[model samples]
Target: MTIALRRDEAGSGPIVERIEGGGFRTQEHYFADGVMLTPRRAETWAGTHDAAMLDRAAIGQLLAIWGEGLPEFIVLGTGSTQIFPSGALRRALESEGIGLEIMDSRAAARAWSVLRAEDREIAALLLPLA
Candidate 1:
């Protein structure tokens, strides 16, 4: 299956326009694997896509998204399932004043589009759906 978003206007960040098996399509390019997205840029993530394998150090690196400007929150797209993170990881983000939101990759992609439309200060890690 494929999920798509309608682009009504231009924006700064790379919007998630389409999400399909094993990849995502943005206005800029197509990501064949997991991706990290910030309000400023999007890049390929070489880290583990399994949410169960994610740790504090893994998420902490997201702070480098825009080089010094941290996001207000983070969206963790855990592949095809909505795997919740450890309490320790959540607390760590809370201590840094960053909220953590977890969902399946497809949902996270759609959510990123909505939040970015409002110009919210956010970042996301989207694992491939298939």
Candidate 2:
């Protein structure tokens, strides 16, 4: 397979470049802004196309990059698919004054690109689900 390199609406891809600020850059994919980690499936998780619920492991990775603690809003792209988060996780984050928005991988990639340009501390999680 061949890869292309160019400034795209989603990301730069084909060749993954680790952006200085955060996130992985490529021709068509821009993964998490801080570090691109391979997220493992949480136990007992019923996956959805529009709502891939985030488990503690994924959340931990997000928080680590979000060293500033809680961000104004967090955009989670549930893999290549877009799955909403489980209710418990949403409520938990809300209780901590964090805004969470679950979008599909594509939208999440776009969202991160837009947000990163302005917000220096804002972070995102983008993964591809099988």
Candidate 3:
């Protein structure tokens, strides 16, 4: 996806123009900003994609990183398959008033791009197939 970032007249954050690539391979994601992120060990956060940070400690890490910028919901892509997180993890996010949607990486990527285009507060956590 080629997301174009346009600067608002008031100079707000760059607006996403396009987003591409949902299929995961080789353990890398090429973002619209031209940054290539390779996540290893299932505990990495690339942009909005978090691999296997489902534990309490890892969840805390996410809270720290997002802080006040936490989105209304998060899309978690479990590699090439759809795997739901433990109930404990789900409850944790729910306790924070955040919704979680689990899907495959491709679906998550597509949803993330669409939500972003609509200016919705959302995040994506994707696990690569490699």
Question: For every model shown, what is its TM-score relative to the native structure?
Answer: 0.91, 0.58, 0.60
Ranking by TM-score: 1, 3, 2
Worst 10 residues of 3 by lDDT: 33-42
Q: Which stretches of candidate 1 lie over 4 Å from their true place?
A: 8-11
Clashes of 2: 16
- lDDT digits (tens) for residues 23-61 of candidate 1: 888888888788889988888877777788788788755
Against the reference, the lDDT scores of all candidates come to 0.83, 0.49, 0.51
Sort by lDDT, best first: 1, 3, 2
Residue by residue across 1-130, what tens digits does model 2's lDDT show? 1222233343221223333223345544554322232121111112232344465455765566444446676677675556777888888777777777787655665566555444334445555443
Measured over all alpha carbons after superposition, the RMSD of each candidate to the real structure, in angstroms, is: 1.5, 8.5, 7.7
lDDT of 3 by residue, 1-130 (tens): 4323332333122222333453332223243212221111122454423444465455564455454556687777676578776788888888878888888765665565556556666655566543
Give the Å error, residue 75, model 1.
1.1
